[model samples]
Target: MAQDKEFEIVREFEVDATPEEVWTAITEGTGGYLWPMQPPEPRVGGAAAFGSTVTAWDPPHHLTIRSEDVGFPTQSANQLEHTVEPRDGGRAWVRYVHSGIFTDDWDNQYDGASRHTDFYLHTLREYLVHFAPRPVAFATVDGPAASAVPEGLEPAARALGLTAETAVGERVTVRGPHGRPVEAVLDHRDAYFIGLRTDDALVRFFGRGHWGAPLGISVHDFAPDADAKENGAAWQEWLDGAYA
Candidate 1:
């Protein structure tokens, strides 16, 4: 006889907070609301289910869950395990691993698991940033000259204060200290925006545009590291490189 193999999905995040703080956010606070599942009580044998069942639980550290078999329009029995580890400098690394034997189509199920883990990590960031917040926004280029912005770059530029003008099909560039300028184009389908961090001069590009009226990014009090300026510069470098 041969042992059956299980499917698994894993996600990781670097949180700028203490392990205890992150744990509270996950177990006691906003973690449940962000993910597409009910709030987990998260106790030993506490029966946690996020489209599944609770198999194992350990506070401020690990959670193991299992899904049951159901037909199409539902899911099969899949096991999910989450782990949190404290890192240096008040940061934490959280990983979500999902495993199970899939009788169903593997690709579709794996894709779904990837999406779920992405959402989970995103929600975790939201919670941590809320506790240690900043000012951010998503801005769309709303004008006739939107054609001047680059394709797949408007949302990101808008987050960084780029706006549309009357010049249709015109190309505009915002130069950095080095290399070619970051180009922006205007198009009809380019209607979405990107996530911008205004506290510092940096914009982050996300795959999907935010869905809602523009909301003000919240600012919270967290002690800046001794190398705060260096960190900001490094982030800016990464953004420039990414957009370049």
Candidate 2:
């Protein structure tokens, strides 16, 4: 029998950017893209997004952010600790540990968050490489998983009415659910992650398995004129049906 999964998660990423950049990406975010909309106010006990509190803050090194489990998307309060260690060649090793209550949705939430680890770290790299100061936004949605990588990728890409091929730096055009002509170039793709940069947005996808298998998708749209809330709502509804 397989070992049981746990509610706490620990993930690490080797980022090519300097420790400073990685630290900023984890804490403040870049190019108008913030994962949780707002970050902890940088000081211990400072205000943060998601009604979380900053338990510790060590610039360019270590930080701890904790928040109540209520009202969050997962509806679970958790604490995330980030440690950034400098590496040779201006690179850094980024580590993240998230611990919280199980709250019954442990399996679904854990699998989903596990898959998201790849997307999150990958986006951190993209943010460092393409650190645009322009405004950007994020959209996170969850659902049943597929079989494997590219399992549901094709379908989602198909809905976009375009081929779903993993080719970094490749350009592609596809319409969103609203029939908006969205064009983007592939930034990175591996067995676990797909990074796409749209004319005014940065989109990413990860994992491909079942409802509890683990898969994550995020969009970072950079266009001061674009409405992220509307975009997120549209994608949420479209995905609910697409994967249903």
lDDT, candidate 1, equals 0.47
Candidate 2 — what's its lDDT? Answer: 0.67
Our model 2 lands, by Cα RMSD against the true structure, at: 5.1
Q: Which 10-residue window of candidate 1 scores lowest in summed lDDT?
A: 212-221
Q: What lDDT does each candidate get?
A: 0.47, 0.67
Worst 10 residues of 2 by lDDT: 141-150
Cα lDDT tens digits for candidate 2, 135-165:
5666766545542444655556555555545
By TM-score, who's the top model here?
A: 2
Tens digit per residue, CA lDDT, model 1, 1-244: 2233457776677878777777666555532223223546566556554555567677678777666763433345677676888999888888877677756456655665565456446545644654333322212112222222335345335434456552433444543223434454321112332322222222223333122122111111122432334434544453444344
Clashes of 2: 13
